[model samples]
Target: MPKAGRRRSAVWACFTENTASGKRRVLCLFCHHDLVANPIRMVRHIVRQCPNADEHHKKICREYQALTVPARRRPVVGGQATEAAKSADALELESARVHSDASAPPTE
Candidate 1:
């Protein structure tokens, strides 16, 4: 079947069973973390694993980070370009709702 979106992290696969409301769950083949039915969150979880994650999980994370060519989703403000910085800035803006929030984005 044709893919809906770009290929996700190599460490995880989506299983489409056991859904009360007919929703699939993305399972991490590495560290088993239960993320909601959101692909972006799944990717974030894989990329930003806990500090004490197992060596295997860390190795997979590093490999994926090196392999994937990240696109510039948000405009670069300062020289430092990192997800942590973006999330921090996002948190600072009380007016800005999270991506996970179902509400529509604030109109400019």
Candidate 2:
């Protein structure tokens, strides 16, 4: 049969018998433990929780976890307010300025 999606990651090599029902589950190669096939849980199991997992598997799991982590968002500079909050504050100030200018009598 043709492939269904992208090739599975090398990290999945540590697991097998991936079965789908209400939730997907896989068998850990090192511990023979059945676990949800979610990547984070798999990595955690191999790296920290699996008693039977060796250094090699733990190293691989750590690398996979590092790779899968979402990139850290850039921090807002100089204040606690985010960009959207600053924009909203600016807009409010601008509208107030415009409203005040409009209400003032015209000068010669």
Candidate 3:
């Protein structure tokens, strides 16, 4: 059973206890396929790969996947030079130019 406030996966509905293995394994209600009590495999089986799975089961499995999977961070473009670093470099260049101009004697 899940904790009082924690979210539970809807894909759990597709699982039934394996009578032979007891709690060690679960049987798929859709295709009667036996699987170990592994959440990743269960989700994959129900969501993307299960030919026997119905639309309802797939929908729930997708929901579970969405909750569990962390969104991928987009890769930084063009080597290093992040936006902050680029801005800082530009500011430094501007300040150096200004400092050089200020130090120089006034030209007529």
Give the clash count for each candidate: 0, 0, 0
Rank list by lDDT: 2, 3, 1
Error of 2 at 93 (Å): 20
Candidate maximizing lDDT = 2
**Structure candidate 2, residue pairs in collision:** none
Error of model 3, residue 20, in angstroms: 0.8
RMSD values for the candidates in order, in angstroms, are 16.3, 8.2, 7.4
lDDT of each residue in 33-63, candidate 3, tens digit only? 8888677678988887677898987887888
TM-scores of all predicted structures: 0.36, 0.56, 0.55
Model 1 CA lDDT for position 37: 57
Candidate 1 structure quality by residue, lDDT tens digits, 13-102: 422223554566644554444556564555456667544356665566566656564655765557855554467666666445554355
Model 3 segments more than 4 A misplaced: 1-8, 72-108
Look at candidate 3 and give me any clashing residue pairs: none
Report how far residue 56 has shifted in candidate 1, in Å. Answer: 1.4
Candidate 2 — worst ten consecutive residues by lDDT sum?
79-88
